[model samples]
Target: MSLHVTNTLSGEREPFEPHDPDSVLLYYCGLTVYDPAHLGHARAWVHVDVMHRWLEHLGYDVRHVENFTDVNEKIVAEIGEKGDSEASIAREMIGATLQDMRSLNLKRAEVYPRVSEHVPEIIDLIERLIDRGYAYESEGSVYFDVTAFEEYGKLSNQRLDEIESQGDPDERSEKRHPADFALWKAGEAHPEEGESGGQTWESPWSEGRPGWHVECSAMSMTHLDESIDVHVGGQDLVFPHHENEIAQSEAATGEEFAKYWLHVRLLETGGEKMSSSLGNYFYVEDVVDAVGTDVVRMFLLSTAYNSRQAYGEDALEEATERWERLERAYERATAAIDGPDAATKVEDAELRETIEDAREAFVEGMNDDFNTREALAALLSIATAINRHLDAREAFDYRGLRRAVETLEELGGDVLGFSFGRADDADGRVELAGDLVDLLLEVREREREAGNYDRADALRDDLEALGVTVEDDAEGTSYRL
Candidate 1:
């Protein structure tokens, strides 16, 4: 089946078709480097990362670009208040963002263009807009003429007059219309805070920085194609940020800015939108620290991308349990494949059919608008089947069990971005300790068989002191840490 995605532009589920058949160009709006990234940012980036992985899995060469708004009013304000250089503040926060991305195991974008690096391109685009009458200069600032673009509000479904202007209220008098937004601000200082001279470049309008919206338009088009296959961000950016991007980019190029617009819905905490002002926002590092990266990624993907997800401890706890179950299933499958009697043939029709059905369902879920929630369910079903087979006393086909393990690794590890390493491998000592524990358990089994019950019990007590639990049953023995 072909892929389908719910395009925010048309508000419809459209079949996936890139401008080029061999490649897909995707641009995700990245963070403004004023603060560390939070869980909301994780939700958007991780979803797009999965989409990137899935497209590559489907044999499309994907060129992904995500930008950084390093030269913004907020960053400038931070510079002034903190008494740091613009680059210093931005660099620090960008480092934090990258660290958070690593923690979440996100695939790095092919291009990470920063606004400060794309000043020349931004100026060039604004120049074209001015020459084309899509924008005008006011004193020194350049404002996009919202009235000039006939389809200015098409993407956001708002009429031009109804849309309110963002940024400095003082600039309202200079705009042709109240809805018009800045293409370039006039001064080096933030109009409101009067924080000046941190990051400015030469421009026709003024020696000032690029506006928030124009930065994305410049960076994305410069890095990717004039027309990209997909432009993704949080749903909250639909209004001024994305809407202004469409207007300026299309106006300058006289072409469609992006073929498909995909927006992930806002992630809420305690039924409220996660925001710094409300003090309910949780950083990505904190979440990863609390529940782990895999659990955080799973929790984000557990819901539909375009649906609002409320963050709660219960949800995270559930994700942790689910992840543990999949991990255990993977380990069990690995052990079964390494068993002494395993062979390379599928003798059981039911088990073979179960694996095939799970694989098909996983693909079906991903094909249906990248519905990760459904895809994850299919993955869990596969793990369940594998566990059931592992528990069966029958001599399973080694190749069939190996195939199941490979499937899990591809879907769970590759597509879902799970690192299936030992859960306690953080300090690099867990693997050695695990091996030692395994050796002790083997020795204890020998003692039990030789009728040395007291010695075996003593060994078990020592193992418990080291935080290992031993369970013996018909399957022999198993240990957990």
Candidate 2:
């Protein structure tokens, strides 16, 4: 839990070794401006936002850069003879994306560089690759010779022999090897071939657009430094997209591209990844409207960033119930602290101890690879203690309750990026929570009967961490809220 991260490059939970002791250079791969952002995108945004907050909380000059791929063919597809230019389409979709980001309460990055704005830098970078003998020109375009970059597949753990064509089939004849990818694609020489031939830029190679992978490298290097502390994106990109990024970036700079590569796992429903092409994704704006931004954020944070999260009716419902529980506790504590029953003479050491322990446990969980699951459990423990104090005691410890509220706001609200105290009632609380507890109790009973006291105790401890208190009496096991 000492500031560790599960780095994709190393495949280990190692200490977060910063490239710079006083700062973190972070880049999150942003959306291509072809469609509105979705819950899948929201998952990454929430996690990256948490990372940014945690780093800034640690007192670092976090220079975060997120990119918008404004000049992709997908943008052209969306235009589709509507008399709308690719640029206009991109602008509209980018607006959609920013709307989602704002609604999700994501912190603004230091810069949101777009591919269109960085074309000069991208052209210069392609020139560097060619000069370094790592790229070549074909007809009027340029392609990175993957075979020349000795470390071509290091990031993806792929070998040149195992790799297939990195570009379109037509490019195979131009590419020396199947794995070579385009650095710049030439516009159609014949204007009759494509309507957007006029959109191409006048480059040293020819009038053309930057390839998908090179756009990120150029934008990142232009906005951030040549080398960065962390480069994060969804896991689905690790194969060809990220692999090509490392190849082209390191080849150009002759230095490491990123110190740690963090890839957030996919969000799925019914075992299929949430994808626009598949028509199986939820638009961010719709979800936020339906459930509210706070519940969506809470639901996303309930699972850690590195784990695959299921998105469905049940998950959303669970998140709603959990948020209500947390919010009700926070509301109760605040009310009790100022109520007439509050007394300066009242002292609750047990409650104070619980608050302090929860605070520490939250930090531990966050440090352990940003494990929000564990951190939420810790905060829920504090919630349970607050409820017990309010439900049982006539007088409240003002100072202790204040500290507890601050801890919740600081750790839960700030770090986890969840908005609490929305004042929702317990009507939405999980109706089947009792049945689930009974199931757990049955499992614990069997474990105890099998003489596995350690396992049974572990189960009890887990239940306690989640605000459930299990009691074994003379007749049977009973749990209290």
Candidate 3:
């Protein structure tokens, strides 16, 4: 089946057909660098990262761009708390956010365009909007004339008339409509100018920074083509942010802005959205520090990408257990392939059909909008099949074992981004076994010296049960299977 994604643009699930099959352009809203990124941030980016990986796995070249809003009111607030300049504080936070992204194992986008660095391009886009009559300058501020755009709320599926009633009152400016959003704001002139006024730049309107929505339009259009293949973010950005982007970008270029509008649902705890504004967010760093990156990443991808997921200690623990099961299955596969005679050889057509069916199910799950939960279930089935094959204890077929091994690596390593291997080198297996023996011997000797003979004997018997021969000599106790 062709890949299908639920598009927010049309409010329907549609087949994903790229403008060009060879390369796809994807843009996602990056973090605002004023505060530490939380679970909400990680969930959005993780789903986007998984999309990038899946597309590449299916042999499509993807150029992904995620932008950072480094210059904003929030950053100024953080700067005030730090007693430092905005630039200095923003610089510090940018570095820290990148580190947090790495902890989440999020893929580095082709470009990380920062709002501060792309001011000139932002101004240029505003000029285009103004020239096209989609925007106008009012009292040293540029606002997108929402009324000029006929399809203002088409992307969000909201009627203009319905929204206008609840729109912000245009008390400060000569806005034609209350729904008009700021493209640029005039930098405040006085009152602790450096701290309160915010970063400024020369523009047609006045010396000031680009508004939040405008920054994304300028950066996305500048790096990617005018019309991108995919535009993605959290579900929350669907209203004013994405709605405005569609208006400004499409109006400026007189073309479609993005073909697919994909939005990941929010990550919740106990069915409540994780938000920085409401003070219900857990930092990615704190999570990684608690359980390590692997568990956190695996758990994040264990659910359907677009579905709302609840995250907490219980979910993470379950993820850890699932990962351990995969790890043990891989180990058993490696150990069972001990020699030419010991391999998992599935020559029967029925058995091969089972494995192939699992593979097909896995691909279908991923192809159908990245349903990772279903894909993971298929993966668990593969692992179980491997365990059953090992238990049969027949002469293992190298061909069957190789196919199973490679399939697991493809699903776990490429799709899930895990590294599970049991052997290291040519003599690696023997070396590891020998090292384990030597360590056990040392512990046994220590136990004997400490007069804990019962525990030492128990350890010796356990090794014997595993087919390791034990002998006591003047040098020490030696064990071999």
Candidate 4:
């Protein structure tokens, strides 16, 4: 199946073709270690994770690259407040961020390059841009000359004149254009120079650090090659960050940068953009702990990659309901399974065809720009069919059920990152043992009401042997794995 993605360059959906069919190179803008990741961060990261999983499912080898901005101004300020070394603080935060990613079931990228470790690469790219006359040094710091790159605002779709009006000054105060962004900022060796508060590095002009945008360019270019298959980030990053990356990377490599630029829409709350700086952010851990990981995964995957989604309590409830419906249908399908000989042949070929059509539509929806919303709708339709079959209690063909499980496993387990299996399935004996223990507990509760202590104690002992912990109170009894 041909993959389609909403290319931010043209603001249109188009068939996605990689530079190499055998291996597709993907780069996603990762977090800056100044703070912990919020829901906004998880939304974008999950979007990239689902996209990569879909590409891999479709038989493409993906070499994923995500970077860490361990050497930014934010990190420096944060480290200073702690009175700890910048290196120490940055390392601690990056490790914590990885732990959060792990909780989300996101695999570590094939290459997680760090900006601090790749300072030389950033310097080399800056020098190349300087040599090419697209970047210039002013007041001992380098700034990318926006006018030198004619298509500077192509990715963000922002006109240079428009951004220029918002006039933000950098070290290049004498720059002919106001929209020009810093490639490097010059500072002093000591904190009292009215420059960067003593957080300086030895560069050609003075001590300082690379800008936020420069880190992605150098790291992505070094790891994923100059021209990548796809560049993904949140919609908020379309401006300035990704825009500058395009200018610097293309200017240095003299090649077209990323062919496909995909931007996931931001998560909103109360109709406003959710932001960590705004103090209106949710972390992935909270959601996963409140519900299960599957519900969180479904909530993230329910919306189209490019469409804004308002995440709230209602949205999470809807996700939980949908997850339960799908899982219940799967469980029923498994229960109805018989040996190959006794499998009931579905009489309505049209019903079977409908199931096939839904599967095809799901793939088609996902293939078309990762439209997970539409794909999930297709799955929900199949779920309706499964419920209809169950309601009728008719001898339905197992083939359709088998196909449904396969589709759920691929779309849910693989692409959507939902764990569809029951918790009891984790251990082979838990399903039966758990059910028997629940029955025993119910019997024990009845016996306790009748003052039959001896029988209740015996039943409790039986449950204990099966690794079930029973808690008794005035209300009743409860069990745990």
Candidate 5:
């Protein structure tokens, strides 16, 4: 099946076809780097990461870009409170955000253009809008003339009259229309009492910084094609942020800004919206540390990307258990291979058919608007079948089992970006440890066979002391750290 996505602009589920068929340009509206990232930010990026991985899996060269708004009102406020320079604060927070994303195993975007870095591009775009009569300069500030853009509300699906003003009331006084938003704000020593200061650049209109909306428009167009394959962000950005992006971008380029718009819904906690102001928000790092990276990611993906997800301790606990089940099934399937020639061995037709069907179902779910929740269900079904088969028979078709294992790894690890192995394995230490542990287990087996029970017990104790739990079962010795 060809991929389908829900386009916010068209309000329809349209077949996804990029301007260039061989490659896809994706731009996700990234975080404003004033503070540490929370779970909501994590969900939005992870959703985009899954889509980016899936696109690559389908043979498309994806050039993905996520922007950082390092120059913003919030950063200025933070600077006042912390007595740190805006550049220093932004650098620290951007680093922290990247760290959180990496912890969740999210692949970094090919380009992470910062608003401050792209000030020239933003100023140029705003100048084009002004020259084209779509924007006006007043008191050194420039605002997009909403009246000039006939389809100003097309993306957000609100009529011009029905939509109320979203800009600051004080800023609105300088705008031609109340709904018109800023392209650039005139530089000021102190816009607010607590604001240390905002970054400014010399522009035709004034010495000022790019507005929040204009920053994304400029950065995305600067790095990607004018008409990108996908533009993504949180659902809250559907209005104002994304709306202004479309208005400014299309106004400047006279072409479609993005072919598809994908917005992931907000995450909730304890039956209420998760908000930093409410003190109910969870940081991505804390969640990952508490429940493990795989569990946190799986929990987020278990919900449809476009639907609000209610998160809690119970949900995380359930995801943790589910992750364990998948890992156990993966281990069993891979471990069933008895010898070096296991790959050449044929499998039962029934097992192969089951795996093939599950693979199809998984692909189908993904193709239908990247339905990760449904795709995850398909994966769980595969795991369940593999577990049942392994329980029924100790020795099964090695090739079929291996095929099943590979499918799980491909879908879960490669596509979903979940790590099934030990976190410390990134540097190859896990493999070395496994080999050493296996050798010790073999020696312990030899000791047991030679009637040296005390030595075997001592070996087990030593392994336990190293945080490896060795269990003896019908399937011989198994160890986990």
Candidate 6:
């Protein structure tokens, strides 16, 4: 069966067809570098990583470009908190973001274009829009004329008239219409006059920064092509962000922006979508440390990317048990290859058929809209068969066991991005993750002894929310995760 993906543009589950049959151009709208990546960000990252892995597994040379919006007011807001200047703060947070990505064992994109570094490309794209009569400059700021693009709201499926104001409040008066988004927001004519306290580049409009929507368009077009195979992002960006991208990009190049638009749904906890605005986000680093990267991958990939996945202690514990089962089964299969029964060279037809079945199911699951949950189920079935064979140790087939081993590593590790051989740091770094709990308890203990009861209570409450229970005893504060 051919691979099928639910395209956001056509609102249909269509067959996978890259613009280039031999290669795939994938662009994921990455995080704005204001802080460390949260679970929401990690969810998108893992799914995109899986997509990359699956395409490469299918022999498609994937040129994936995931961008970082370093030129945002949010990065500037972190001046004193993260660094002294805009560049310094971006550098600090970008480093943390890259570290977080690495810790998750994500496949690095071909290029991670930063908005601050792509100013020239952004300006060139915006200039095209202006010259084509699709954008206008007002008060030194250039805005995309939403009305000019007849299909302005095509991506998001909202009429131009019904949409609310697009950019910053100061931009409302300068726009031809409230729905018109900024291609270039007017900034200080010089980098020194930063009331917004951000780095600026010299452009025809002003020494201003590129708007959020235009950054992706310029970066994608420059790195890949004006018309690409796939564009991936979070579900939340469907509205003004992606809609604006289609308008500005097509207006500039007069070509289709992206053929397939893939949006990953939100990760929720306590029935609330994990969001920064809602104050319900958990950092990717903290979670990875709590459970190893393998467990983290297992937890995220438990549900399909387009479906909502809940986050909680119960879910993670279940994923932990599942990973342990798969890992143990893998070890048993590997060890059996050179076991006491190795000389037997017995080929169990049943085991061989089971391996073939698992491979077929894995491929089918992957083809069916990248259904990782189903794919993982197929892998777990292999573990079950492997366990059954090893447990009934009366003349087991070493050849069959070898096939099972290869199947597990190939399907489980290669496509789904699981780490079956974690002997390196599974013992060291994962055990060290426990120290975080102890450190937090130490701080809470200080708060309690220092007579800051409210602060102590707040810490305990925070710990409880994170699935860690804090207990106070005659000895001291003890916690269980």
Best model per TM-score: 6
Error in Å for residue 183 of model 2: 0.3
lDDT of each: 0.86, 0.86, 0.80, 0.79, 0.86, 0.86
lDDT of 5 by residue, 345-423 (tens): 5557777788889899989989999999988888888788887777776457787887788899899899998776556
Query: What lDDT does candidate 1 reach at residue 183?
Result: 87
- Assess the local accuracy of residue 115 in candidate 1 as a C-alpha lDDT between 0 and 100: 85
**lDDT tens digits, residues 80-170, model 6?**
6667778887876777788788888899899999998899999888888889999999988898898888997888887877898877797
C-alpha TM-scores of all predictions: 0.86, 0.86, 0.83, 0.82, 0.86, 0.87
Q: Give the higher-TM-score candidate: 5 or 6.
A: 6
Where does candidate 3 stray beyond 4 Å?
164-172, 188-196, 338-341, 344-351, 422-481
Error of 1 at 235 (Å): 0.6
TM-score of 5: 0.86
Give the lowest summed-lDDT range of ten residues in model 4: 189-198
Q: List the residue pairs that clash in candidate 1.
A: 343-398
RMSD (CA, Å), candidate 5 to true, equals 11.7
Displacement of the residue 60 alpha carbon in candidate 5, Å = 0.5
Candidate 4 residue runs with Cα over 4 Å from true position: 80-83, 165-174, 188-199, 338-351, 394-396, 425-481
**255-366 in candidate 2: lDDT tens per residue?**
9999999999999987999998899999998998898887998899999999979999999999999888888889899898778887888889989999999988888988
- Cα error of candidate 2 at position 308, Å: 1.5
Compose the digit string of candidate 4's lDDT tens values, residues 371-463. 888888888777777777767755666776777677777777777777666555644565777787778778897898899999989988887
